[model samples]
Target: MRNVGAFACGLLFGLGLIVSGMANPAKVLAFLDLAGHWDPSLAFVMAGAVAVAGIGFRLARTRSASILGAPMQLPTARRIDPRLIAGALVFGAGWGLAGFCPGPALVSAASGQPRAWLFVAAMLAGMALFAALERLAAVRAQRSQSSS
Candidate 1:
């Protein structure tokens, strides 16, 4: 039942992306372009998304569990640390360059877009690399603690 609910939600999200032209790289690039024929349509979409998410978060804050009876694991981090800043920069760079963030990239890839496939592959590689680097850092920290 949980899996079914998750699938339904994901399918709906993908459909929304497609309907909103978010899954189209050209549309996204046009939206990003500021000086040359800038398209502000995506800005409206983004604003709507932000508004909806804000309301959803506000409601979720009052709940202990999700509708699926699972624990509500919302983000707890509030401080804007260097790591967060760096991550935001990296994410923005990727989005600007490829015109496809993770969600839209996945939707495009599922629709058999070649560029989206490449983007998804690169994204996965970056995630894997980040995981490996984190593991290495953890090991170094553990060793340093043991030596101390």
Candidate 2:
């Protein structure tokens, strides 16, 4: 049942992206191009998303657990550090270069576009690389602390 609900929610989200023209790279690129042919449609879409998410978060705050009986796990990190800034920079750069954020990239890939597939592949590779680097850093930190 939880899986079904998740699937439904994902379907709805993808549909929203498609309906809002966010699944199209050209549309997204135009939106990002402020000095050129600027598109304001994405701003409206973002506003709608923010409003919906605000309501959803408010409602979620009232619930102790999800419908699946699992406790909700929210982000606890509030501090901004170099890691966060670096990650955000990379994310923004990738989005700007590809004109497809993660959600839209996945949705676009469903259309069998080669570019979309390549983007998703690169995204996965980056994620794997980051995980490996984090693990290495953790091991090194542990070793250093033990030696001290």
Output the worst ten-in-a-row residue range by lDDT, candidate 1: 20-29
- TM-scores vs. true structure, each candidate: 0.98, 0.97
Superposed model 1: Cα runs more than 4 Å off: none
| Cα lDDT for residue 43, candidate 1 | 94
lDDT of each structure?
0.97, 0.94
Can you write out model 1's per-residue Cα lDDT over 1-148, one digit (the tens) per residue?
A: 9999999999999999999999998999999999999999999989999999999999999999999999999999999999999999999999999999999999999999999999999999999999999999999999999999
Score candidate 1 by TM-score against the native: 0.98
| True-vs-predicted CA distance for residue 22, candidate 1, Å | 0.5
| Residue 77, candidate 2: alpha-carbon lDDT | 88
Which digits, one per residue and each the tens of the lDDT, describe model 2 over residues 18-131? 999999999999999999999999999999999999998888888889887879876678999999999999999998999989999999999887889999999999999999
Off by over 4 Å in 2: none
